[model samples]
Every structure is written in structure tokens, then in C-alpha cells.
Target: MAKSPYPVINPGGGPMGKVIIALVLIAIVTLVIKYPSDAARWVHGLGSVIDGLVDFFRTLFG
Candidate 1:
């Protein structure tokens, strides 16, 4: 068998990764709780953008 040349490194490999993820989750939850309407609007706008892109591609190919 032959060995590959590259070495693998994991970014989120330890307790620090868990801490970072938890902090991010906390921040997102805080934002949603503090500004529910704004978060909803942002999500709606993202969906609209995705829908528009899909429609554009469908029209272009069809």
C-alpha cells in the first residue's frame, strides 16, 4: 500500500472548539430573542434570494 503525502489537521479538535461553538450558539439565541422581527425578516430575505436564483436558473435552462 502507498501512503498519501498530505497530513490532516482538524480545526475544531478539542474543548476550545466546543466552547467556541457554544458561544456562537449563545450569540445567535441572544440576537433572536432580542430582535425576533429582525431575525425573521433576515431569514425571509435569504429565502427570497434563494428562490430568485432558482427561478433564474430554471428559466435560463428551460
Candidate 2:
């Protein structure tokens, strides 16, 4: 079987990592859903950081 390019992330894996990722994703999604403008500004403010993260995921999954 081929290994996944992304980390072997078990959604229900270790409690702490799961919780943190869940909360971060929730916060991002909530911000986007509730306040699109603010979300855009926040992402802009953290421009490089956000870009790096996006790139990281794309690389991991691509």
C-alpha cells in the first residue's frame, strides 16, 4: 500500500494534538464564516505565516 503524503494523522489520535488542531480549525472556520472581512484582514496581517501554513499543507498533501 502507498503511504499517505500527509502525516499519518489519525483524527482521533493523541488527545492534545487533536484538541489543538480541532480548536485552530474551528477558530479559522468560525472567523471566516462569521466575519469574512476580519478573517481576510487577519490572514493578511499574518501573511507569511498563513502562506507558509498553506504551503506546508499543499506540499504534504500534493
Clashes of each: 0, 0
Q: Local error of candidate 2 at 8, Å? A: 20
lDDT tens digits by residue: candidate 2, 1-62:
99888987676668988789889999989989999999888878899888899999999999
Model 2, residue 32: C-alpha shift (Å): 0.5
Superposed model 2: Cα runs more than 4 Å off = 1-13, 48-62
* Maximum-lDDT candidate: 1
Candidate 2: worst-modelled 10 consecutive residues by lDDT: 7-16
Q: Clashes in candidate 1: how many?
A: 0
By TM-score, the best candidate is 1
Worst 10 residues of 1 by lDDT: 3-12
For each candidate in turn, give its C-alpha RMSD to the true structure in angstroms. Answer: 3.1, 8.8
Query: Between which residue pairs do clashes occur in model 2?
Result: none
